[model samples]
Target: MTVDKESDKGPYICNGTQSSDPEYTQSSDEVTLTVAEKPEPELTSDLKGAALTGNSVTLYCTLKLQSAGWKFYWSKDTQSRETETETNHYFIRSVSVSDEGQYRCRAGRGNPVYYTHYSDALWVTVSGESPPVSLIINPSRSQHFTADSLSLSCEEQRDSTGWTVKRYTL
Candidate 1:
């Protein structure tokens, strides 16, 4: 019996074989399997608005990848230190004033293919221990106070930045 050689066209032909050879076909399929590189991870923080003093804040870093086979890394801007590889989330428990800085993350399988991406710098400001306490007089109690006239003044004991003054009469 004589067997005809397969044409070298299309995916069906493997090493010029008409009959499907398990070894040849299996090896060929293995070669065709593609391992896609994971995309860079996205970094985000749970901090927003003004952080309050003595507040336990969790800074979350999320790693979104095109491929599932990837590990995540987290870091702060002050130092180029990397945290442990997490599959999903990274957190900073009981955040304090000192923990304020920029952060970022990276997604990678191992060496050579690793990539890093930085997130926007978030300024974490801790609120004062007490709300801005201020004393104001609807009508100023000056030495020369005149009747039927309104004079208003504001006195803020605490130092505050970005404060707006308003006067209301009842």
Candidate 2:
């Protein structure tokens, strides 16, 4: 069985251009670094949609090659080192407006380690404005039988004047 390096890790994305050195060579009297050259680490995020303030955000550092025994480092825009991970990912809990910004990561391996160049930077943003009202559906089921009707409705909280209920046929 192969172990997955990304399992149970938070989601992240690399936003901008990535830089990878073609070859990083380090040799010792008894050992030579013969591992195949690896691509630049990739930064990624789990925000599929809009990210609002006060939510958790997960960031990932991914290597195209095996990431075993690699140490990862992270940095935010215009800042020194933010943090480091022994593994290939990092988590941001309770993200606020301050957390919205560019982030980058890189990896290093072996003693007196040779480091991979930083991955592309990612820009993160959080919205503080109130979210828009959304419609809700009744009879919450994954699959519905044909010819069966479902109830759908939306309500506006302002002055109680924006409540709407409608039905349509599929």
Candidate 3:
């Protein structure tokens, strides 16, 4: 049997002797299969809000891809990235005042990957520490009052003029 090689198609046999078998006379067709690369995961979360100084806050990021399985990574602003290969959730154990900043995440299956970042900065503010100031009231010893009332004001020492005092009667 003589084989014929064609550039457009593939190898074929042009047997010198005509074959009585139909299989030998027929040519086999070839099909090409292609698999697309999966897209990178997307990071989704709300990082902007007011949080207490020592309170724990959770920042979330999600990866949406064509494939079911993937790895997730979390990174603080300008810091080294942390990878969570097994799970989708990223947890911040104790969110501190300094820990407040922009955060991002990346997701991919393997190398040659897709990475989606958070579009806007997750702005977080740490509740201020300065405690509210207390006011002192002193009655004049020289003055004796009968059936009289006194007015005292409680003002914040930081910005005394800016404070609005509210009185509560018990």
Clashes of each: 1, 7, 0
User: Which regions in candidate 3 have their CA more than 4 angstroms from the true location?
Assistant: 1-42, 46-48, 83-85, 111-120, 128-170
How many residue-pair clashes does candidate 3 contain?
A: 0
Would you list the clashing residue pairs of candidate 1? 140-151
Query: Candidate 3: RMSD over Cα atoms?
Result: 14.9
Off by over 4 Å in 1: 1-30, 33-38, 66-69, 85-87, 111-113, 130-170
Give the distance in Å from residue 148's predicted Cα in candidate 3 to where it truly belongs. 49
Better of 2 and 3 by TM-score: 2
Q: Compare candidates 1 and 2 on TM-score and give the better one.
A: 2
TM per prediction? 0.47, 0.55, 0.44
Comparing 2 with 3 on lDDT, the higher-scoring candidate is: 2
Model 1 accuracy (lDDT, Cα): 0.56
- Candidate 2 accuracy as TM-score: 0.55
Alpha-carbon shift of residue 92 in model 3 (angstroms): 1.2
Q: Write the per-residue lDDT of candidate 3 for residues 41-155, one digit (tens) a residue.
A: 4454444557655555665555444356566677678577565655666665555778777766666555775455533445556674433556544453456488766655665
Please list the residue runs of candidate 2 whose C-alpha ends up more than 4 Å from where it truly belongs after superposition: 1-38, 129-170
lDDT of each: 0.56, 0.73, 0.56
- Residues 131-153, candidate 2: write the lDDT tens digits: 33446667877788889899776
Deviation of model 1 at 72, angstroms: 2.1
- For residue 123, model 2's alpha carbon misses the true position, in angstroms, by 0.6
